[model samples]
Target: MAATGTYTETFVELIRRASAELPAEVAEALRTGREAEQRGGLASIALNTILENVDLAREASAPICQDTGTPVVWVHHPTGVSTRAVKADFEAAVREATARTYLRPNAVNTLTGANTGDGSGRGIPFMHFEEWDEPRIEVRMILKGGGSENVGAQYKLPDGKLGAGRDLDGVRRAVLDAVVQAQGKGCAPGVLGVCIGGDRVSAFEASKRQLLRPLADTNPMPELAALEERILREGNELGIGPMGFGGSTTLLGVKIGVLDRLPACYFVTISYMCWAARKAGVSIGEGGELTWLS
Candidate 1:
């Protein structure tokens, strides 16, 4: 790969400036989670500690709870910009970030996969890519914690169209299924990342990105927004509550992003975000950048 201009970074440099921003947002969710806990839901003391750790991690430049997940990369390339030489540029950024951040190397070989334990090599950080309109390369990074990733899932619905095929009810079923299946394993109370439309692949991407949005943010689309509200309402009603303690707040936030699906396939993906939600990402373009996120 021929080097042009490279913007290299460590996780430390990606979100540090956003530190002041992440807490208040997460605290709001914490308060809500606690309230639900009071109402016989979200029995998540583990989750409480996780959120506390996020705040502490930001102040300390720590890994934000050891899972230090497989790196998720979102790449936006401008039109006419050929990425022909960007061999795993996304992966490179993640590796560089991991190495610099001193992330605990966790990748291992499947057949002969060695832990190598150096924060490099296969599987440590999973790369998810997107090519969008841009002149310069734009990369976004999220360290997807293992606990949350373990809770990720997708299911097929008949006729694959949003609002037509599975409808909102189907989505609720999937959410509860995910929560019940996790059973305090992935750490709770958790956030729900959902994708209602698109084929299998796009749905998965939507679900993953749902984790990237600020935890308390809202969808602008009216119907989609309504669905988010109802899902949040019912998801809390699950009684899985926090950390499997029978309560009203099993989920922290129900974040969603939808893609219009083709008639042939509809996919509902549930990406679980454990209490830590220890995800940090970067944006470089018109906006300035920072590391050690909120």
Candidate 2:
């Protein structure tokens, strides 16, 4: 696969690593969130499970859970690359892998809402794409589960400052309001990602990217970084804690991705409640090759 300049190995690794590693972060957060219920002791349990799961998954290279989630695939095609047919071809590769790996199928016909007979076990892995201003192809897959997805919300904001109506603080308030409304429903002890600019589509795109930012990386802009930190702190203070069982750690992190919007409306898109944030990513090469993730 490497000799062919394809990303096959990376793709395979994505599946294998996700299976094993996902449980650690997921279970730990859940465990800790649980402990937090009573002085947040249950948090230890989640943390412990996280530690154990990673150890076990590494020793036994398998998926963390059977529901590997919608395969959020991001592909960046370089300037010189011809992607006219790349998207369709990659979709085919996904189907082939699903069958071989026996991944749960997630695609359904909207009109009929019926399942397609494939290795996709009814509903599983989803694919999203974009062309980058680069020459190399970068593909990432996030096996996002469904439980946390339900808590997402969007708002155009009433007299939003972005629309030259009020101030930026309104957007922050909306975020807080959304999280509070979500409560423990989202399987707390999670993360909050926000998209603060662009139209509906681009704003959502920015929000999606926030989920991909490495957990340890800091925002280059101090203002944005501080805002993220504040959200994480304040969000945790909400007491939504693990599995909604009740705890102090309502969120593991808060990531905000923003782009300058037009002088119309400040669109805010929030994605939340990653029960365990069970996601994995990988890279794919040219000529329709795939690589796995770690």
Give the TM-score of each candidate: 0.78, 0.77
- Candidate 1 Cα RMSD (Å): 4.5
Model 2 residue runs over 4 Å out of place are 1-10, 23-60, 100-102, 119-135, 159-166, 283-294
What is the lDDT for 130 in model 1? 55
For TM-score, the strongest prediction is 1
lDDT of 1 by residue, 45-134 (tens): 545665676677767766665666665655666665445433344445445545755366667666786776556575444554457765
lDDT of 2 by residue, 1-294 (tens): 112324344554555555456634455545555555554266555555555655665676655545556666666666765443444444455565566552555566667878774534332444555678655577665666666677787777664433322234666677777788788776566677788877887776567668877665698877778878877778788776655555676787778888887887777788873655656655555554555443
Which stretches of model 1 miss by more than 4 angstroms?
2-5, 10-12, 15-23, 35-48, 79-93, 100-102, 128-138, 158-165, 285-294
